[model samples]
Target: QPTLRKLVGGSSAPQLPDDSVRQLLVEADATNELFKYCEGQGYSLFVAAQPCSYTTQVVAGMIYTVSMSTEPDPGTYYEIKIFKPLPHLEQKARVTEIRMAQR
Candidate 1:
């Protein structure tokens, strides 16, 4: 998977679209919050075992970058992150939301 940097082009493309960039950041923030919440609840967020590679998928014309982390010991938590750009609202706009499954 290519990092956003490469996809959006380098610093040379200074004029990167504002909306999409904003949405991508939003998704990152949401993912952070979700991880924090799980940790606070004393649950280990288990992504997946390596050589683990996160599968990035696009749905509804929006790009989704996903990865997993796992801590095996007592409690286990599953995290699914979805990043969707609201291109319809404004071209190059994205927002990320996350759903968690725990056992």
Candidate 2:
């Protein structure tokens, strides 16, 4: 199951969005970044990347490993890794890797 963390200072405060929420956002961002790092390189995804699933690695920062599929093309998926540095770092998030996923 996805974990939900505390969002506000008090116990009664609402919970933060879980991994599923993060994955949806990541899918959108990854599609845009794909054009940046993948288009000319041969990854010509003709449609929006629909989120399939994703995993997260937490270190000094967070690495999001996302699997997405392009519409009208079943069985074709791409793996995108995005890094989000700690809040203290003040660094902008970036897409570290974008590649086709083997079946």
- Each candidate structure's count of clashing pairs: 8, 0
- Per-model TM against the reference: 0.36, 0.65
Clashing pairs in 2: none
Expressed as tens digits, the lDDT of each residue in 1-103 for candidate 2 is 9997744332233234367536545544667876676677766657776667666666677776677677566666777777778889987667888887656
User: Model 1 clash pairs?
Assistant: 20-92, 23-94, 46-69, 46-70, 47-68, 47-69, 47-70, 85-94
- The Cα local distance difference test for each model comes to 0.44, 0.66
Per-residue lDDT of candidate 1, residues 1-103 (tens digit): 8565544421222232345443554545644665676687786655632111233444555444333335553344334445555566554433344444444
Q: For this target, which candidate reaches the highest TM-score against the unseen true structure? A: 2
